[model samples]
Target: MKSWRTMSICLLTLFLTILMGCSFSQESGEATGSSIILEFSEIETITDAGVQLAYDDVHEVKKIDNSFMVYKKTASDSHLYLGSVRDKQLTEYGFVGEETYIQDFTKNEESLFGRPMTLITGICGANCVENYLFEQVDGQPQLILKLSGHVLVADLNEDGEKEVVMMQGSPQIEIHVYKRIGDQIMKVNLNEEIGLTNSVTYNSQTNVFEMIINNETKQYRYDTDSDSLISL
Candidate 1:
């Protein structure tokens, strides 16, 4: 009878040990899955040269973050450079491109692919502008998507995700819609051209996208399940 009692106690001890081991492993796995969140500072123009400039003839110095900066030249034929701040000086690390007449530099209020994005607007031609959407990957800015002409960024379907709507044309105004799906910004085919004369905007009061085409107002609602726009 004593032998049986001893054996039962041994089995109970072994079971408790296994249970504690599994609990420790589950907690460790949760810690490994955690990630770091990046925060960006307000967009500030570089007025003083306290921080050394990247270019001798700089048109503008746009501070994207505490570490990352953008420098543009003063000439008509100029390029944009992704820079870094160190020891009160700006150093060029990534070359954006030439003939990039930067008009606006700002951060998107909406997150893309569960991450923040930066939007850079540049002149493509007369009465034309291109929107360059960039995401930070491995500590470097990477262009994920580009939209031309009159563009609007909004949560069209109110699905907690924003979509890009662009009114493009000179010959004829055609509205184009783009969404970020699985790390790719794909054009959502409306299957028909929605012409616009003035501009496109998201009416938060009504929760719909509206535009004035041919001096008349038209509205559209984004269908999340169908992945298309519904005319209203």
Candidate 2:
């Protein structure tokens, strides 16, 4: 009886240890699986020498956690950049080494520039004061794309289910894709980029996508498979 009890206790401990190890592995995989590389152009109201007010549009790359890299130019006309240090440790998660890294700038700072800084970014361009998608109006997610924009309701991946594509939502001049989940309309940020043309058309015969964005740039396409944009 004593031997049987000891064996049972040992088995239980081993089983619990295996379960904990598997749980940790699953959590780590989730973080690695859906990690995205966010890239976009951001506008900053840069004040330069002689009291010059200029909007410097800089490209940026970052992670989902908001850690990022900003590109800049200085007075010496030399190239400059900023990013996290790889040799240093990350303060957020306390994981050894920084998950995010920055590259050092090689240019001299222009004294006249009012502290080259970031002014955050919008979904569209500077012309779009606010992105309706990011804002919650009247308790609903903003569906604000350009009023005269056309949406693509074609199947982009050749899959049975079609995807919704919209023209330049913001900083990047890439085609925007979207999927519908119930009543809300969501922007599919990252996907296979097909360039930044204002229009995209499908060819049933050739089975190729065509660019027809020259005229009537305001028109938006609705997905025929789900018809979510209209209801969106």
Candidate 3:
């Protein structure tokens, strides 16, 4: 009985020490930040050229500090996937024209029913562009990228370019907008959720953008300058 009790205490002390050591190391290592990489076998190569091209396009956009909203094509039994990479790395992932499952590393969470994905360019702020997954109304999944409000306006300045935006959460607040000129995307913020029925059209003047809620007649105005509503 005495020997067993001594052994138990020894084991407990060792275990506690290990746990403390791990915690300390992780806290210090966080200062270095983390990097995400897609692993491929050395002898393996991309088989689908189309998929490869799509990935390449997304990758280029990301390199310029842009975000993407991509969806997987699950409609009619078709499989499509899209992703964005920056500097030969997987920065943002998405699906094009469909719905997809998006994994979030920051939150370590996954959700369903994301919106249709789009590629957001010219978003200017550092760490402005974000990535996400989309799930369409037809029960499909996709990926999405986003840019912050500051980044959007700064990038799209002095150009007659439509802004692209990125937002967070299920409802998608705080958007960042972007546009492409030649090869680079000019970005801006299209903030303040446009309120309306279901769908609406945006004219260049008077109202630069428009929105509609789910099947309603109420139209709303979006202001890009201060990230607020101009009218509703």
For all candidates in order, the CA lDDT equals 0.57, 0.33, 0.34
Which candidate tops lDDT? 1
For every model shown, the clashing-pair count is 0, 13, 43
- Best-fitting candidate, scored by TM-score: 1
Sort by TM-score, top down from the best: 1, 2, 3
Which stretches of candidate 2 lie above 4 Å from their native place? 33-129, 132-178, 187-232
Over the full model, what C-alpha lDDT does candidate 1 score relative to the true structure? 0.57
Return the TM-score for candidate 3, rounded to 2 decimals.
0.23
Model 1 spans with C-alpha error above 4 angstroms: 1-109, 124-126, 189-219
- RMSD, candidate 1, Å: 17.9
Q: What does candidate 2's lDDT look like per residue over 1-232, in tens digits?
A: 9999999999999999999999997754332322222232222222321121122333233332233233333333223233222223211110111112222111221211112212122222223321111222454222123211233444543545543444544333445555434443345432233223444443444434343222422222233344212111
Q: What is the TM-score of each candidate against the true structure?
A: 0.49, 0.25, 0.23
TM-score-best of 1 and 2: 1
Clashing pairs in 1: none
